[model samples]
Target: MKSPGLTLVSYGGKRYRFDAGALCTELLTTGGPGEFARYESLHEPADLLRWVERSRLPSGLEMPVSEGELAETRALRNALFQVVADRAHGRPLAARELAAVNLAAAGAPLAARIEADGSRGWAPGATVARLLATVAREAVELLTGPYADRFRECGSGNCGLLFVDTSRPGRRRWCAMEHCGNVHKVRAHRARRAEGDD
Candidate 1:
């Protein structure tokens, strides 16, 4: 029951596909330098609940989320983005950002459970804090884990999404080949044609 807006672009390997879930918090930030015109998907409490319901989380975690909880979730997302971005740039993660994620995760009632298909997944408590805490914990694990070294910002001029480069050679440059990769190829082809005409 994935959310309609939850677009999962495969970039990393199977174990790290959750990176796309983390980056889905923000959208369309590749317009310009420091462009903050990004479209936020979690605009309301209903949006948050929808995400929780549709996410690949354990069942029985759906609950009525409040506006205040939505605000807190946004804050958590920002902290995660900062940590991941810093790691991508080879900068040290700030202690305060890590603290913010840990504080939220401390209140989460998440547990590992086996799904009907025998796969393991996280099941959060029937509370807003727990749901958000699950996501925060994921960010913590990703930023601190060895895969963090594979972080790469998208090379598209208008797509600044982040992804883990799990390629064998570790040279992945776009968030998705069908999207940014094609864009780059087309642009380059056009430029070459223009040069030939000149």
Candidate 2:
């Protein structure tokens, strides 16, 4: 069975995981950071297929993706990352970066459909273009929405992942409480104990 919102992969003594809350943010986290080095999950066409299947994209894509399409997806992913990183750092997004995302998003055959529950849903073509479009739409929405103000980079050492802080108090300090938060807590506790002993 597919485990939604809890995909875990290990690197450098740390378990890199996804929260499935946001598609664009999750795309940026396919690689781990620091001494764990860059662990790219989408290294090949098959890898991209796995990611698409695992992510359960809203576009409902099933894959017989080409290597060229995978390359394009990776390029789009990098562009989205740059856009998000710039926005998080309070820097203005470059025109070229925005253009790249917009151009890819335009290629997807997306349409609004009426759902069984009388709600609107997006229906995208069953192609890599559709997947890229879905992800690009997510990035644009995140970067331009009111929630953009809540974007934060992980505060853990060398854990540079970005997340939207949805906490009621808006004081979230880690990407995942069980991951970086616990690490910081344990480190602080050890430091305090050592100081007391000294």
Candidate 3:
């Protein structure tokens, strides 16, 4: 089950729990440009549906995804990924990437509703485009939001996972303390022991 600000991410056949701080950045886990292309999952309509299922959006969303919509969604995801990476690394954001994201945001976002049981729900007639619009719109908000400067990549040199550091101290350094952070700690301990043997 997807929780707000957290997602179960699968890459290279392993799953890691990630906190992306926003649904928009969570979309980046599906794929990206260059090395990220290897992890691409948005090949067809059903693929996008699965992603929606794992997303932070209130669940029970039944959306129709067209081939055209899938294509647009991938493009938006790649652009969003690049922009966030640039933002996290303190590089200048690219206009082309920003434009791609803005184009996707042109559609109306998914409407939310209250079910008979009082549970939050997505309105009927959901479209992939609309769902992605919600993502893009949030991307715009996050990029310009007060917490925008908190965007970051994992501190581990071998890991490229991205997230927003929402800690009270704003010093979050890895995807999760239980994941990459643990691995980094173990490696540093081994290196220290090796040095002591010299």
Question: Best candidate, lDDT-wise?
Answer: 3
Rank the candidate models, highest lDDT first.
3, 2, 1
What tens digits encode model 2's per-residue C-alpha lDDT throughout 1-198?
A: 244454564445666554635776777766533332366677778888777656635434455688899778777877777777677778888888799899876765446577798755555446778778878887777777877876778888676777666568877778777787888999999999999999
- Tell me how far the alpha carbon of residue 139 in candidate 2 is from the true structure, in angstroms, after superposition: 1.1
Q: Estimate each model's TM-score.
A: 0.73, 0.80, 0.92
Q: How many clashing pairs per prediction, in order? A: 0, 0, 0
lDDT of each: 0.62, 0.70, 0.85
Better of 1 and 2 by TM-score: 2
Q: What is the C-alpha lDDT profile of model 1 across 48-79, one tens digit per residue?
A: 66666555563455577788877777777676
Candidate with the larger lDDT of 2 and 3 = 3
What would the per-residue lDDT of candidate 3 be over residues 1-198, giving only the tens digit for each residue? 356654454345556678888888888878788999987889999998888877788789997788998988888888999999999999999999999889878889999998899989988888887888899999888889888899999998877878877789999999877778888899999999999999
lDDT of 3 at 161: 79
- CA deviation > 4 Å runs, candidate 2: 1-4, 12-17, 32-37, 56-60, 109-124
When summed lDDT is taken over every stretch of 10 residues in candidate 2, the lowest stretch is 30-39
lDDT of 2: 0.70
Clashing pairs in 1: none
